[model samples]
Target: MLWLYLHFPHLLLDHIRRTREETGALVIVEGSGQKVIQACPEARDQGVHGGMRLKTAISLVPELGTVRADQQQEARILEDQARWLYRYAAHIVLVPPDGLMAEIGSLQRLYGGLPAAWQTVEQALDERQLIAWPGLGHTPLAARLIARAGKGECTDDKGHIQRTLGQMPLLAAEFDARTCTRLQRLGLNTLGEVFALPAAELARRLSPETLARVQKIQGTRPDPQAPWQPPHHFRQQADFVQEIEQSQGLLFPLQRILAELEEDLCWRQQETDSLLLVLQHRHEEPSRLRIRTSGPEHRAEAFLNLVRLRFEQHPLRAPVMSLQLSVKRFLGREADTGQDLLGESQDLNEAWHTLMSRLQARLGDQALQQLSPQADHRPERAWTASGVQRNNRPAATMNDQLPRRPLWLLQGPQPLTEAPTAWFAGPERISGGWWDGQRVHRDYYIAQLHNGQLAWVFRDVRDGWFVHGWFG
Candidate 1:
């Protein structure tokens, strides 16, 4: 099996740097806060390096930023990276503290070739602003060793992998100090020399575990790895080295997260109707913004636009230290919306959704209302207000087959003082509301008034003629 190993030498520092807008000297200090364990390029330029005392690093760059290393946090970040790599390869093995390994043998045909697969992962790392060393080998152990030793290269040839592994220094093989000391006494300086020894004699000299490690690296033994599986729901977060005081500042990181979400949805062949955005603060409670679409949506732009509108409406309550976007509600795949024969989307539904989403965002959700037909026979109570939706009931379906009602209905019926100039279609009898307190018995007609306005006039059996409404 062909395995690809990615070594992150500065995962902790990279994790912290990605959230910052400015480039500065930065380093990750050990938990003791005495020695620097990892340093960025800017810090190296300022003469800071790993293993240097924190005070010494600060002496070089007085403005250096430092973050204490945490094993738990680093593992979580590593899993986050694994989550991203799982999109490309199915079989992934997490190497704690700094690395990830994936079996690409099964993906050769799917991604075209080894070069393409390597490029895909490399591109993702670049986009994520991460620093990694990638190595390829016939075994996971070999690939990981090559990557950690900084001898990584993209090649699947067994001969090349063997040669690269052979040249690795004894120390870079990750053997214990005692083993290295024993090998050094035997004048074995490189892996090539040690590997040249007879297997039986080598096994007799080395510990069982060390011998097994060597055999696994040389592909002489099987090294099975448990594959990593993504969680059922999607939740991605971004941390900021600098706190974001304004809502607009949060959008940059949010844009990247949303794009990742779009990719996740597309990969799953599904859509979602709702998203929950949580903004973590330094001292105050986190602010939660729930974004709901009119229909199942998968496009990143649509989500981003709605989020932007939401931010415009609600200002930030506190400075945000981190932001997380999650979608728990998974919806079925939407049908092909309005694609034409030419493959271009007619976008009727898309446009309608956009309009409704924007209006709901600008106006409160309750501000927009839809008119839905009710069972009432009274002209004024014939329709009720409903929430706006992507698919609205056709207006023609309301009161179908019934006598036409004027499009514009007056608040109350007015007494008709003057006679009608002409009478149009009319004489529709209406009687209802006995179940309630008020009962109505009338003969409604469409008549043209003296001012050329077509009015809805009704003669109440108990009262007199009254103008009820007007037709557009």
Candidate 2:
């Protein structure tokens, strides 16, 4: 079986640095803050290196920034990476503190070849702004060792893998200190020298556990790994090294998260209509913002635009230390919107929904209302304002057989002093409201008055002719 290993040499340091907008010499120190464990390129250029005392490194570069390493945080970050890798490979093994191993033997055919599979992972890492060393091997242990030793290369040839594995020094084999020391004493400096010894002889020289490790690395023993699975819901966050007081400052990190979300949605072939954004603060309660779309949405630009509009409406009340975006609800994949011969959407439903979403974002949710026809027969109560609902079908048109109605209806019917000069359409009787206390009995007509104004006049059976509404 072929395996791909991803070794993150500076996972913690990279994770911490991505939050800042400025570049500077930075290092992640040990928990005790005595020595540097990881340093960025800027720090390395300034003569800062891992294993150097923190004070000495600071003396070399006075402005060097340091963040203490946290094992829990590192583990969380590793799991986050695993979540991302799961989309490409189904069988992923999470190696604590720095590495990941995935069995890509089954994926090679699906992804075309080893190069394409490797490129896919590399592209994901690059987009995530992660620094990873990828290595390929016949076994997981071999892959991890090669990646950690910085000798990673894309190759499925077992001969090449064995040759690369043999060249690695015994120190890079991940053997225990006592075994390594004993092997060094025995004049075995490289993995090839150790493997040259007979298995029986090596078993006699080393403990059963260490012997098994060598066997696994050599693909003689099984080293099965449990695959990592993603959770049902997506919750991603970005922590800032510097607190941002303005809402605009949150957009950059938010954009990164939204892009990842768009990729995830595409992978799942699903969409979402709601998103929850939580802005963490240092001393105040987190500000919560709920972003809703007029319809199921998957595009990152659309989400970002709506978020920009939301920020404009509701300014930040507190300085944000970090931002968390989550989506728990997932909608089924929408049907493909048919395109015309030129490849543009033939239906205007999507465009209308987009317009409504933009309007909702700019104005309050309640600001926009849709007029829907009611079942009432009374002219005044024929239609009512209702919440907008996005649908593929166009609004129902008025039937030609139905009586003509005015576009502008008066608040109340007024008595007409003079009769109509001419009648365009007439004698449409309406009688309803028996269930309710207010009953109506009238004969409505479309007529033009003496002044040549078309009016919707009705003759109330109990009263006289009254002008009810006007036509545009």
Candidate 3:
């Protein structure tokens, strides 16, 4: 099976630089913050290079920016890239700290050919603003070595792969310092010279571990790689080298992250109504913002707009150092039955949801309410106003022959000081609330008042008449 290995020389540096608008000198230092592990092109142009002492690097470029390396953060960034690559290949093995190996042999037919698959991955990397050296080989180890040596190619020829593997220096063979020194002392400089020696002689000269590594690279021994699967829920974080003092400064990074969420939801063929956004501060406690929609939505622009409204309503309490976005629950996407085949029809429900979401974000979650019909015979108890429902449920069926109710209703019955000038149609008896102890027995009618105003009048069993509501 053909394998594709990707080596990111400066994964951390690239990730940090992608969010910056300025092309300035930047370097990623070790945990101790004493030396540089990776440098960007701008830093290199300023005579800054990897392995340089941090003090010396800063001396060379006074404005040089440094971000300390984090094992957990690096792992998260690598996993994020792997999740993107998973779209092109199913079997992917993450070589932590800087590499990814994918088995693309089985995908040749699905992608049309090897070259097309190679180009697809390349384009995906470009779109994500990442840099990777990719290599193709018959074995995972072989592809990894070539990629690490900056000699990756797109060819799938077995002979060419072997020849490329043979030309690699012994240091690129992934051997320890002692083994490389021993091979050098034994007049072995390149992997090709070591391969020319007999297996027995090589085994006699090298330890069993080194010999096994050699056989693995040569494809004589099986190198089984455990496939990596993406997580079910989407959680991504964006860390900054410089503290962002303004809330507006966070949008640049949030745009890209929300777009990825859109893609993930689209891939799952689902939607989400809730998102949790956390803002880490320099001195203050982290702020947690829960942004919710009126209904299940998958559009990035819609989510971003809601977030913007939230930001306007609630300002940042402190300088943000990093931000994390997470979606814990997912909802199934329902088909848009309101539209036609040509998509010319406008979805009124979608528009209503958009408006409600905006108002909720600007005001508070508890500020808005939705009116729902209740199963009650009394007019006042027939409907209820409560929080908006996220999932759409089938509306209760109603008889078309039933008399219509007025939109405007009074708080309660009022004394009718004047008699009705005319009567429309009524005598619709609604008697219930017997179990609730608030029994009501009245005959309602639609009548016009003497002041030329339409009103709803009702009379009780004692013949006492009153105006209960009005007809708009």
Candidate 4:
């Protein structure tokens, strides 16, 4: 089974910026630095293109709308789109900020074949007001290339993969800029020309190696892709009456989101063990917040409890526009009487969700937070405050018996004036990983200091005494 790879090479950052700034205006964004990111179709019609210098492109179409490409922002929106599309296909491969590939082989059968599946996907995207060109083929590469060449629909051909692909320009092969130029100069502008060349001869002609790539795209060699998998059976979402800012605003919104999720859990006949919430903000990347249950839960109230506690301590830093919740792990659903209550229980969930909504209306995403585990063994390294739905694990947990640790560690250890330890544990000397050049070598000690602060101190073989962490 091949795949449906959709390419949006021209859906550049300029289009987004312009679409926001001037509706119906043709825009082509060129990154200020070295790389070209996007050129609008209108700009392309004027002979502008991706990778063309911004100034040169403007010279081609003096009136062309231009903006510096925000690669980060474009990528964020693309990811959010990918996240939403997970509901359609379990396996989705994002082709970065502009495109995606979905394993539609299995989906085709479910949707009653290729065309039907394509239509279903198109319809879903339409609801979101996003347009994508779909290309169906036996391989991910083939599908992607054909789609970029603007093949809107795949003709039925169980065996005509090469023939269908023969029509596309060679640039669709994802060749390097120089290779593409070389192909054009040689009048081998089409895939058919490239395909006609004997593999051995073609390999010998290319620089930096082309034999392997040629073989992969030609289907003579297999190119494997690791498909993206959506988490099993859990999601939470909240629709804001208005966009929100501040960590305080999330409390109420999350309340309703949890309530809706509680119902979804019931319908799925599953109990959530661990769930994640993805928060999307206007013009910024979405953040992820995840919670793990000590045990499986179907109770809406209990689920909300954890989210509430997390929000109380941390709030949003920026205003959020939308919220998405997903369950990464879950257990079998078991009916609970509390959630089954007629109206009052549901009301509480609604109230809490409402409160969160109001808080977000004013506080923004940066004001809200949830503590996530850290990987480091240090106490202060235990957790970090992250956006509600941000996915960052806690610091590494090393052997607890390594040494005495501190509960409260300074953000950056403060310099101590005088030595205050009554009893000292032997210094464990360790250092040297300066390849990237942020080097540290210290003799660490467990000391009961003067002010009754049991602290972790280290003396660099050179820098004398420096406090590292504290055991509150």
Q: Taking the tens digit of each residue's C-alpha lDDT, what string does model 2 give over 203-305?
A: 8878878789889999999988877878887777777766788888889888888988998899899999889999999899999898988888888999999
Quote the RMSD, in angstroms, for model 4.
Answer: 16.3
Would you estimate the TM-scores of all the predictions? 0.77, 0.76, 0.83, 0.49
What ranking emerges by TM-score with the best candidate at the front?
3, 1, 2, 4
Model 2: number of backbone collisions: 0
Model 4 compared with the native: what TM-score?
A: 0.49
The lDDT leader among the candidates is 3
Residue 158 of model 2: what lDDT? 85
- Cα distance off (Å), candidate 4, residue 166: 1.4
Say which candidate scores most in TM-score: 3
Put down candidate 1 lDDT per residue, 166-280, tens digits, no spaces: 9999999999999999999999999988888878788888777777888888989898888888777888777776678898888887888899899889988899988999999
Span of 10 residues, lowest total lDDT, candidate 1: 390-399
| Candidate 4 overall lDDT versus native | 0.65
Give the whole-model CA lDDT for all candidates, comma-separated. Answer: 0.87, 0.88, 0.89, 0.65
Q: Give the winner by TM-score: 3 or 4.
A: 3
List runs of model 1 lying over 4 Å from the truth: 110-112, 185-187, 197-205, 332-345, 374-386, 392-472
Candidates sorted by lDDT, best first: 3, 2, 1, 4
TM-score between candidate 3 and the true structure: 0.83
Report model 2's TM-score to 2 decimal places. 0.76
Predicted structure 2: lDDT: 0.88
Q: State the displacement of the C-alpha of residue 384, model 3, in Å, after optimal TM-score superposition.
A: 4.1
